[model samples]
Structure formats: C-alpha cells, structure tokens
Target chain A: MGLPPKRGDLILYSVLAVIFLASCAASGLLLFTARGGSDLVLEAVLDGKVVESVDMKSLKDESTIEIRAGGGINVLAAGPGGVKMISADCRGGDCLRMPAIDSNGDVIVCLPHRLIVRVRSRGPAKASPIDSMTY
Target chain B: MNEESSRGTMIRGPRKIGMIAVLSIVGVIGIFLIDTMDGARTVTRDGVAMNTVVSVTLVSAKPKPQLNAILDEIFALIGELDKKFSMWNEDSPLSEINRNAGISPSAADGDLYSVLETARRVAMLTDGAYDPTIGSVTRIWRDGTGEGRLPSSEDIASALPLVGCEGLKLTSGGEAYLERRGANIDLGGIAKGYALWSIRRLLREKGVGSALVNMGGDILAVGDGDGDRPWRIGIQSPSKDRGTPLCAVRAANTSIVTAGVYERRWEMEGREWTHIYDPSTGFPIEGDLLSATVISADPAEGDALSTAFMVIGPARSLDLLRILPGVDAIFVLDSDERGMEVLATPGVRDSLEMFDDEYRLTFVDVY
Candidate 1:
C-alpha cells in the first residue's frame, strides 16, 4: 500500500549500501591482518621499563640475561616455552624459587632487583578479565 | 499512473526523512563501536617498593603518554610511601621514630599517624596478639634468618620484654614514640595494606574507575575489571612452593590480604620459625592454621587481622570474626586428623572456588 520510491530515496539507499559494504571490507581486512603473525615474546622489565624482549617462538637453547640493577643482580633464562629466574642475589632468594612463566599473564618478580620477567603477546593486546592472585 | 504519482509525492517527504534518521543513527553507532575498540586500552605498570613487587593495572581511554604519566604518578606515590614506611630505609620517618624511641616523641606525618592509629586499634582488638612494637623480636629474627642460625633463648627473652604495644604512645597531634628505650615499631604486617589503600585513593583521584593494585600478594580491586566482571583473585596456597593458588575469590572495590607462615620462614635445627611473631611469646605463632586470608574494605585492617588470626588461632579468630562486620576471613589449617582443611567466613563461602583438591572447604556460619 506504500507509495513508490523517489529519486532522493534511491540516492540515500545507494549511500547506505556503499557504507555497509565498506564497513564489511574494513572489518574483514582488520581480522585478517590482526590474526596473521602473532607470536609470544618474553619481556624483561626493570624499574617499570622493558629492558629486553626475546621472541619465544625463535628461542631454542637456554639464554640468560643477567641484569644488574636496583642494587641487586638477577639471571633470567629463556628457553622454548617460557622464561624463569635461574638465579638472583636478592636476600630472600624468592625470585629463584618462583615457577617458570610459560604463557601470557605469568610473571616472576624479584623485588630487591626491581625486576619483572613475563610473557607477552607480540600482537595487539587482548583483554583478559580472568585473574590477579593475592598471596 | 497519474494517481500513483500524486500519492508518491504526498508520502515521499515523510518516508525520506525517516530513512535519513535511521541511517544517521546507524552511522553514529558504528562510529561509537570503532572508537571503543580502538581507543580503550589496558595499561599495566610494575615496580618494586617496600620490599615487594608493586603492580598496577588500569583500563583507560587516554593516549599512551597520558597513561604513562598516570602510571608514573602511581609508582612515584609508592616510592614516596616506601620512604615513609620502609624499616630498612635509614632516612625513613619510621626509622627516625625508631631512633628516637623512649628519648623523645618524634613528629610524624598525617599518613604515619593514621597507619599507627589503625595498628593500635588492631593491637587492642587482638589483645597484644598483633602489636607493632614486636619490632624488637622481629629484628632478632631477621638477623637470625640472615645469619642462618636461630636466636638463643637469652636473645629471644631479652627481646620479648621490649615487644609490647603498651610502650607505643601516639599523640593526637601527630607524634609517636616508644615508652622504653629498646622498644621498636615494625609496620611490616600492615604497610603493604596501607600502601594499597593509598593507591586506591590516588587512582580514584586520577579518574581511574577500574584498577588492580598488587603489593607482593596483597591486592586491592577498584571497581569491576575488564568485561565488567568482579576481579578474580587467587588465594595463595600455604605450601613450600610459594605462589601456588589454593582457591580464587571474586573481589570488587575491596582489598584482599593473606598472611601465611610460609611467606617468611626459616628452618634451623629441624625447626621452622615463621615471621608471624607473638608479642607475648617472642616466637613464631605455633597454631593449627597455616595461613589466613582476610577480605575487607580497609586493607590495613585486613592486613593486621590476617596476622592476628595466625597468632590467636582459628577458634579465637572465629569468635572475633563473628562480631566483626564487613570483614571475612579464610583459614587454612592442617588438622591433626584431616590432612588439609580450609574454613571461610559466611560472606566468602560462595565467591570462593577451590583449586586444590587436597584441601576441604567449609563455611563458618556467623549468623
């Protein structure tokens, strides 16, 4: 029972259809690029700054990064799947006792050395609403 | 054809306007979605202060530089607080107070006074089970732990006389002093909690609605985390392997503190001595409980209570907790009969998710 469409209405429809297609194209491109080359990386942060990062994907044999900062020394060993604090001269030796970090969100901190060894994603950060452990 | 043309003109104006409105709304929504996905980012910063690792995680829509600045401010705040509270830092106000103990009242800042006030309140509530003046005994233990030997009974006895909260006098005008020359105050039990409480306030002042502040293993959750879910905080297991999670508790806008014998302990002569010293006994707490996790609005209170629970044992802790509102506790004890047992206050029984199968969880109904 409606009236027939006019020229202006056709123009509006054409504009909307173009925008929808463009949006789809852009989203598709984003997805493809975002998923292409993400690899895990191990980062060593000292005093809130990232001092070093090693691509975990390329890691083979164990490599140690000895950092002497914040009035102490820490040795970080990185292997295929993860990184661990092999040794630290901190008073409590708590850092050496910490478990190896195998995936993202795992962290090993040496308070005396002011060092943090963690795993991070090389790609864009994804939101993890999961956890914060309280000891 | 003529009739159809005339009707089309009559309705075409309203129909075109409606189409324009709908398209406009869709375009706006699309832009908003893009903005949210692109602009919102989670920023995390970590540093070491107060003899512990401090981590702050926040969700912000600000630019990179601004977010960095905010984090810088937080870390700086922690550093400043460290200088005020650290026992090892000789230039700290607390050290100055210790130096002037029994000789003269040391002028204190508002923050120091406030923390001491809380410490005093908790000391009274626990009836000397947890006292800030235990510094005398703590120092002996600290020295012993470093030297890889146990303090002699004579040393412990001499230090025990100095470990009394009654000697700690705090004036209302922001001054504090120990009544005896050798008496000392150690804020180790509650310092991290107070730091977290201060950090939470600072984050709110900086317009940060959501954050997770972790000092060592003590945590303060501000608002809902990403995805609008209450933050899941793992309660560390009281075992030889530290950082192992026994359970996870959902938290929002509150502080979680866990005091465990495993945190700071040393083995000598086939005996284990922990850091939770009893002011009356001048020795590590020898109780059924292994660790105590406290959930409260005030981190300092939770901190002190967790230590107090370790000293007073689970039976007395339950009695006190029954009357204390807005405070929940989880006690892990090695029962003589049961291998491992976990007990939680009524409030936390539901939010707790057990991760370790070896421990049994039970609810203590205060109601």
Candidate 2:
C-alpha cells in the first residue's frame, strides 16, 4: 500500500500538467496560423536551371517570352492572373496543357525539353524545405 | 515507537529528493524534444548554373548564414561542373573530347570520367537506345532547329554512321576516345543527372541530413520534408490546356527524372521534330509516348533511363523496365481521343494519384 500524496506534490504535478497543456495549445496555434504570407513569385526554369523570376505584383502587362534550350523552345506568357506556357515546339504540348499557376507551390513542367515554371511564396511560406521537385 | 518513526522519516527524505530530481530532468528533456521537433526550419537557395535554375531546399537546425554558405559552395560546384561538361563551351572538357574525336584518347577528369562511365554503362544496358555518341546527330538537329529547317536525308545519312555508341571507347584509367573520325559524344542527356547525384553526395558529406537538388526536371531527394511528410512530386500533363497535374507521387530519398518529347521541338516541312534521336535511324524518335518519367535511387540511372525509354517508346520501354531492378517508370503516351494514356509500373502506380479525371490510367505488371 502507498502513502497518501502530500499537498506539495499535488501542486507540483498540477503545475507540470498545466505547462504541458499550454505548450500543446501554443504549438497548435503556431501550426494552424503559420501559412499566412501570400506574396507569390513566378520562376521559369529551363532544364533544371532557373532562367527568370517575375514578381506577380509587377506583372502589369501580359508578356510572352521565348526560352530555347538545345532544340526545344517554350513560349511563356505572364499576365495579371498567372503565368503559363502559351506554346512550345515540343510534340507533347505538355507545358501548354498545364494550368496557369498563381498560387505558391504550383508548378508547370515540360519534361522533354526540361522546362519548369513554378509559383513560390516570396517569404518562408512553410516550415519544410523542398525535399523533391517533379519536372 | 514515535522516536523510531521519526528516524525512518529522516532516512526517506534524501530518497524522495532524488526521485523528484529525476522527474524534473525527464520533464525538461520532454520539453526540449517538443521544441526542437516543432521548430525545424526550411532554408532555400537558388542560382543559375548549367543553363538552368538550380535550387536546393534543406531542413536544418543551423543558422541561415551557415546554410547559405553551404548552398554557395554547392552552387559553385555546379558552376564548375557546367564549365567542365558543357558542350557549347569550346573550352569544356567535353568539347575537347569532341574536338579530339578519332585522334587519341583524351585524359578525362574524375567528374568527366565518372559521367562518361555511367553513360557508357547505360548505353550498353539499353542496347544503345540511350547513346551518348549521338552528338553528331544532335548537332544536326540543333542546327536545323536554329535554321528552322529539317536536316536533309543526305545530312542525316552522313551522321548516321557517327551515331553509334560502339565508336566511343573508355578505359578504366579515365581516358575516353572516339574510334571513328566523325563520331562525336554528347553528355547532354546524362550530364544534369550526374551533377545532381554529385550535389546530393556533397550535401550528405557536409552533414546535411535532408535536401532536394532539382536541376531542371532531374530531381534527387534526400529526406522527408518538414513535418515528417514525404515529398510530393507532380508529373506534368501531356495534354493540351490541362493545367494541374496528370498525377503526383509521394517520395523520399529517391531520384525522379522525366524525358518528354514536348520540351524541345521544331516544325520542319509540316512535321514536328524533337531533340531525342534514334541512333539507328539518326532521326528523332517518333512514337505515341509523349514523355517518360523514371524513378530510381540513382539519379544518373533515372536520367539515362528516361531518355532511353523515350527512344524505345512505351511498349519496349516497359519491357525493359520490367527486367531492370531498382527502377520504376511512368510513360505518358499520346492517345487518339485527345487525352493521354498513363502507363506505370506497379511500384510507381501505387504512389501515383490522378488529379485529372479525363485522362486514362493503366497499371502494368512487368514482374
């Protein structure tokens, strides 16, 4: 049989329980509210190399730019809504098939010619670093 | 009896104090673990090298300055690799090899030799479907694309004899030679993959536990993303105006590479030509496959196999992939109904999630 707990022991246990709960609440709040910043930057990468980065805020005019790598060429259009591949000489037309990317972490990839266009948040948008990217 | 109980209480006092101390230490460690696990930060760095934007994202406990310095070193290494491997640069080792074609075996640097050895091994494995010796043919297509004209049959025929990988010989001592006078070697198909593998090794050596090295579309993933989640990779759609992924796969510590016919293409005489050449025909491979994406532990294997699969088309490539161990693939083939047929190996099929309902997905069992 065990002896009855003392008042001092009860107070210490209660203090630790409260602290644990408080930390849990704090971490929960931090995790939920972490993805707040929304500033987006569009990046154009050809064959794994970044060629151009355009701020979404500065895209006042729709512009078409041609990116040529080896024998492949991709024509990209940047506008107020988002950036997209307008046309490409590659036979698959995969880049042209990709939707316009406006939000962070959305990407359009042309695998044959190794072109990638992606939208990324200007600031530290999320906690995890990039672990992998699909072309 | 009262005096005896008092003496016993005195003895228990120090034992009680020791128990309390141990509990406090446990509590503190618990708190520390929670804080460190929740506080993991992701640092990202990007730079232009190898004619593409190279980006590295790492999850680290280190300060930003230290992380940035490591990234700077990686970028510098990539730049040096680009200088060494780029065929366009006249001073590059690869260009020198091309310039010295048929004359003598050029002594290759460690990096060059490693890439060439991998390329040669892959060439042999794929039965020359993925030849690095197609430089002569690639040059013709590059010049043709620049001029917006197709290479004539005469030109293609002349380059055909020069397109065989058998013409290039590499010694175990890091020397490379082209056996034929007109034969040229291009590492374009496999160079980026080799660079990514090297970068991943460098990061590992630098004590980085997790990272992603994406050179264009050739990707090497090291560890889990933030929050212990597997990395999500989206496969590009081959259809028209279908923005959103055809599919996505979750991966960690793997390399993903895609070779498609959609990126580099030129129109000549009302026909479209891509950069990938068939060594046997000395022309761009024509088939239903729009792109081939391969996943493997080795980045160079993923890179070389992606190109080889693109050349061999879907059916033959799937056959090849079935017999090959440690690799899986997804082939996006052009369909008659304006959509695509997504064929994947069982391993790849398990992780793939189809985002678009319009496309067809077929799972193949090659085992």
Give TM per candidate. Answer: 0.84, 0.74
Q: Give iRMSD, candidate 1.
A: 4.4
User: What is each model's TM-score for chain A?
Assistant: 0.64, 0.59
Query: What local lDDT does model 2 show for residue B204?
Result: 83
Candidate 2 residue spans exceeding 4 A from truth: A1-36, A41-80, A83-101, A106-119, A122-133, B1-39, B240-243, B337-339
lDDT of 1 by residue, B1-367 (tens): 6999888778877767687768766875675466446745677887777777778888777665777898898888878887898777789999989989879999889888899999989999999888988898889887986788888899999988887777889887889998889777899988988988888888888888878888888999988765446788988888735556898899988999999888756678898778788888888888678889999999999999999999998889999888899999999999788669999988987789998899998898875
* Collision count of model 1: 0
Question: What range of 10 consecutive residues in model 1 chain B has the weakest lDDT sum?
Answer: B31-40
lDDT of 2 by residue, B166-253 (tens): 7888888788898888787888889889988888888888888777777776887788654467787777776543334678887778
In candidate 1, which residue ranges exceed 4 Å CA deviation?
A1-38, A71-73, A79-81, A89-92, A123-130, B1-40, B240-243
